[model samples]
Target: MSQLCNVLIVEADSKNVETTVPLLRKMNSKVSYVKQGLNVVTHLQKKGFDLVLLADKLPDEDGFRVLRRIREKAELKNIPVLMMLSEDESKKAAFESGASDYIVKPYMPYELVARVTPYISLVLDRQKFTDECQRKDKIAKQLDEAFTEMEIMSRLDPLTRVYNRRAFLEKITDEQIRSRRSQKKFTLLLANIIKCRHYNERHGYECGDFIIKKTAELIHGSLRERDLTARWSGDKFMILLPETESDGLEIIQTKINKVFQESSFEFKGMNHRIDLSFSSKVCTGNDDLDLVLKEIE
Candidate 1:
């Protein structure tokens, strides 16, 4: 109430209603009144309130029943419900029934104001902090998702869904550092389509693009999970086999060759077997990546 707050005041009698409503209004709170238990439930369902000043008695139902119902609701259960204790009502019973705070009353205005004010302020502050955290979490999740998508688009070839040339170059640099630290070697294999231009001329660029994409898929599927493959150029591809030696390279080459022999590109009615030429080099940790790539050229 000292800070801004919304409070629901449930009072049945005319005298108590008059006293309680004005007392809450003087504190500059957004106050709502419900003279019955059902109306209390209705107002709470339809709106958000920081605090509820529930009278100990309602015309239609016991105030404790209303309090229990509010507590049962998932959404409304957290709002601080202060019970207005009459002379006959037991404060212990009210507390046991989940009353957040209680005030004994023959309408002592100052005591009423003092008791209700702090609870309203505290609940509002807690709600404000909760809302702010939820907003920040949503924004963080959106940012994380956006960054993930941007990273994928940057690192991968859009057409073939393979690692792009730039991504490959960056990875090889990291691999070079790792190899140097470990004193282990890795192999680089570059493969080029022999007559990709002729295939494009014979069919269309779309057909040639299909061939490229399918070849990339085959090469990627042929390798171990640890091996990295990239689309180096329009008609060229490269592979990095980590912690590999000459024997490993030879074995990988045989697998790829077998895959190539079994694979064929079919357009319309004609089937064409694409030919690939491969060159490989073993890096001893210090070989310049640019110079090493030049060997395959």
Candidate 2:
């Protein structure tokens, strides 16, 4: 009784409306009225109601038809519907048409309130449960998105926006297993920026960082989509070319050398040319991963 309730009275009778509206209002219920059964669904769609007071007789259509229509709608189907009937009207027909309960016409105020009160309480409880579930679902979705973003950020190098050393090691390990199973050779290349320390001391650390970032971009752009590149150390990068042999390695090495030789970085109004030193090893998955890393590094 304390919780606010919305009730729709689908009755054409003035006497019934006068009696029912005032009594329900006294009980803290907000009431709406529609004289035609055709308007029942329209009203419910516009402003949802907790309970419906449907008279079997309406000006436009039978009240049973309106109840069935309400039951058909996905949004309004679960609302409690109380069918108001004349003494001679068949209660059996109302129940079959999906009435939650029925009341005889010319009834006492107490009886009407008694039948309508329980449904109001039930609806309010149901609404509260639904709202809580939807809230939890929204929170769960937001948490899932946040966790996914954190996982991606953890795998990436902040400056160059490529895989960091730890993530690259995991990827290369998996690729090694796959290549072994297929008996295919894959190439690993380690690259170092020539005279990187000299540039950092002469120009500044900012210029060195720019050179590193630009080199990562050039190497990433020159490789095939399947190739993986990672920032291995301060001025060193590692590349994994899956299912590649000596010819593939040579082609990639030449391409990377050409791009590096052609590209230049502008620092303090001066264009500084950059160069790289490369070492490569091809493995058929039988090589010790630690030894291979040591030899290349």
Candidate 3:
């Protein structure tokens, strides 16, 4: 690799270290030597090495510990691990622990080279596969996050955090379509917050803003989660209550009136009880949502 032919070689025996170091060095490879498996994890994270050469048995810990740690890490898991196994059982355990390849102890110089070459190739292939999968997963996650953000943005008023006009309309359209498909009843409640205009005239613009925000909160808290509510304009609010009948609409309207009737606005000691007058219509056709809204208005 153009970046760095990095390898972490953990060998407790000095003779194997001496024999392997020179030949590995001659290949223009950078090597990290350690006799303990305990230090393997720290070195792998700190150094960002590409290959890990771990002896199956170390002074303090066995080779499987390092392999397990590497597999656990999302970043380091894909790095090639060339394990030194002494027996068939050791080899099986290393393979089970997700080692790419393993060579037995008392390994020859040429045998090490042969095994090392194929192991590196295997690591490169696995790394490529991993990178591709990550790239796709990241893209999918980004798309999902983006869609969620857009959906949230559409549903909420930018300043007031209430449902925006667009979101309100979209929900109305959805309810209309469903009502048409199922012939289920629905209602559209159009509200005129009359106090907003009075506040705008008597007080400064800030007072009007405060009034709108308070009105939004009062109504939002009064509604069910399934209810679609939005601010249509400075003084107008819209609610699309799906699967609702005339009785349900009247009941909801009564609840809304009670909620606003009990609440008081005391911002900056400017005490006022805002009145939000609402009018609604039971939907008969789905395709004529705009027409129904117009009739409600």
Candidate 4:
């Protein structure tokens, strides 16, 4: 492979270490040497190795015990471990103890490299597949977030930062259905900015936009947390107070009116007052939605 593979050699014999290191390095591999079986797991935990060349005997512990220890660890369990055995050592025992493969001692250099090649290739392929899956998942998550933001932007009035006409209509329709099922009443208040067209003509469109935004802010600030406010159309706003009676409607309307009357806007060295005409309807599920909308308009 083009990528350098990491091979950990768990051998205490200095001759064996000297013989094995150069052969593996010729094939573009980085090798880590640990003398004892006790250090194998610690070394493996610290670095990611593609293949582990475990000696049948170690200075401190048996190779089979080391293999079993690697298998016991959740993170180290899947790493390919090739056991190097003497002529008399049991190859069956190597496999049973979780060796991916085994090499008989006094082996040819080419034989050792040949046996180790396939496992390294397998590990590199698996890593590539895992990296691809993670990349795709990140892209999918970003796409989902982008779509969510687009949906939110579609529902909001860009000028006022409130629900637009289409969004307000959908919300009121759903609320109507809910009110019907619960047998509850809701208050729908529509406010028309009196002589807004004249104001726009007298001043500029920027000043007109400022007045609309200011009116929306005052009305929204005056309402309870549960209330929904929307910019229904040009120079018109709508409010939905859920499960509210006429008494509640009167209280909210008075609060809104008081806020509007107290508020003033400055434009080009002039103070301007906003005048709005309000119409309200107490609606149940039984009310014809189209008729109610027409009446409010």
> Local distance difference test, per candidate?
0.87, 0.90, 0.81, 0.89
TM-score for each candidate, following the candidate numbering: 0.64, 0.77, 0.59, 0.79
Which pairs of residues collide in candidate 2?
none
Clash counts for the predictions, in order? 0, 0, 0, 0
Model 4: how far residue 199 lies from native, Å: 5.6
Cα lDDT tens digits for candidate 4, 44-86? 9989888899998888879999999999999999988999997
- Using lDDT, rank the candidates from best to worst: 2, 4, 1, 3
Q: 198-265 in candidate 3: lDDT tens per residue? A: 88888878888888888888778878889877888877888888889888888888998998889887
Error of 3 at 93 (Å): 22
Write model 1 residue lDDT over 149-265, tens digit each, in one string: 999999999989999999999889989999999999999999888899987998989889988988898899999999999999999999999999999999999999899999887
Model 1 compared with the native: what TM-score?
A: 0.64
TM-score of 3: 0.59
lDDT of the structure predicted as candidate 4:
0.89
Q: Candidate 2 — which residues are off by over 4 angstroms?
A: 1-7, 14-33, 38-50, 61-79, 85-98, 103-114, 265-272
